[model samples]
Target: METEELQAALESAGLSQYQSDAYVAVLELGKASAVEIADACSVPQARIYDVLRDLETDGYIETYEQDSLHARANDPGDVLANIRGQAATLAAAAEEIEERWERPPVDDHMVSIVNRFETVLDRARTLVAEAENEVQIALSPAEFEELRPALAAAHDNDAVVKVSIHAADESDLPDDDALSGTVTQMRHRTLPSPFLALVDRTQACFAPQAHSVNQYGVLVDDYSLTYVFHWFFLTSLWEVWDVIVSERSEDPPILYTNIRQCVRDIEPLLADGATIEVSVRGYETGTGVRQNVSGTITEATYAGVSTASGEHIPLAQLAGQVSLHLADGDEDWTIGGWGAFVEDVEATRITVESIQYE
Candidate 1:
């Protein structure tokens, strides 16, 4: 590259014109006095001293006063590295300021436009995967047609897809050809809402009424706001028209069983010293009863229960007081007619032996 181009590049990288010229001159002359540098670089003698001071401060050049002003350019590698480092620092500081100002509010609703039909489909697939329990979708025939592939993808991943459409037929939608069987588990429903879909009780998106027969539409992903929309649709819209709906299971029994197992695993981790307030519903009474108690290794106390019968009792004393019986197979095992137990010293499972009403 020419000297002028190199000078321009250096200046663009944040070196002053004089500093760039002086450094180029130094590179050519090997080493030079301030007056010689100024003459070679076409910089004014008065400004040469200021330019040298800046170069020295930036570690781009070394200066020595040996009876006269003496200056030499540092390594070219070192100069470029320092300039790059300074630029990065400025960029990082700007990013932090931008992030603070651009932070999103928790309650704010956000709308984004997806011009491509495929992008909208991908987003819907992502929403289905993130859904915890339920999913609901309302789409026009054209948009629903585009979502067939996305629906199959969701089904392949074991997601329960519940779709509502305005005019699409159930037989027309895509079927799972890989298994040589149709996607029979999809829930199909009919909705009058002029939009595409709602998923996970959180996100909702709408197809443009203009492109309800062809192109893509505006997609909204805010959950809290969509709940309000759902409420309005259920109350105001559902009262007027006859809505057709269908539902199918993904893995109903496995889902419920997994939830029960999770509760069982977490129960033991609720240690002896832990206090929990539980509202339990009885099978026979069919009413939820609230109970709060603190349990320990040696004793359990029900301070929240004001009745005299609800007083605390030691682990060993619980056998007689609660009509406890030990299981024959396990020595440390016991059963109690009431809900109270010892920790590690003895484990007890409670059953509904009887309920006495005062």
Candidate 2:
């Protein structure tokens, strides 16, 4: 390196401007009196001795008397070692910054917008691993495979994992055994779709599809914000899809996250005068205080016209007041799903505790 560059580097290495210049001068001269170093560099003659003394004390140079005090450059073994170590640390830090730029670590923010979808997925993995009640996910087939391990972990924890796998063709579909132990329900979306994962009604990770003009990711850990994404997942990514695999129990004590699905499953049984008893977990509509209601479902009401197939309620039918009428002794209550403002209870979870055949 040039002398000026070397002096600048020495200053960056923790040497004062005077010390770096005086050291460089002494190194070039091999040996020099204090006055000679002051004349050879920018350091004033008055401060040259103090500068040389400091440089010597720091092991950058050695000074001794040979007729008069003279300065000489030291071996620089320790100095070079320290500078190399600093360089290596800087290089490693630069690489770490690049890696984070590509795929950032999951942040602590309640809501964060990120540049890469991988970041959203990584956060989803974390949330899924910690899931307690339910997990809803929609992704491409390949992406589903990528998250299978986390889904399996959640499933093992008894978290209801409902997955929507979207692909352009049937060739990308997962086999029946693929979701056997990893998912409670798996559906197929016959087209490319955006990525979404909602965990426990409190966290959500969302990313637009590749075909969109812009690509970005949103991570949410707030209940109010996640609720919005939860509905988006249900209406757009989930409800319309065709079920490919389902592990729903045929007996009582079934857990339902979606009230519409609970109604669809038990509607016929109720029509046949089968007494369906359930435990509903949700908040009171007007007060927003959490409460539980357990009793027999006496009736169900919806707005849209019923489909001729009668297999499931149409999504349009559920848009209006789709509520379950529960009778607990003489007292009765109306339970609504998700966002329930007009009903007595906004149900978040419903467990069918027992069923009685009349």
Clash totals for all models, in order? 2, 0
Report the lDDT tens digits of candidate 1 across residue range 1-358: 9999989978978888889999888888878898999999878999998898898898888888977788988887877686688779879989988654433222336776655555555666566545543445555556655656655555555444555445445565433442122122333334444554555455765555454666655556575666565544433333233434323322211121111222232233332233222212111112223321212222222223222332333222322322212222323222222222332111111222221222
Q: What is the C-alpha RMSD of each candidate to the true structure, in Å?
A: 16.7, 4.5
Per-prediction TM-score, please?
A: 0.42, 0.77
Model 2, residue 120: displacement in angstroms?
Answer: 2.8
For model 2, name the residue pairs that clash: none
Q: Flag regions of model 1 displaced more than 4 Å.
A: 1-14, 65-68, 86-128, 136-159, 163-197, 207-358
lDDT scores in order: 0.50, 0.86
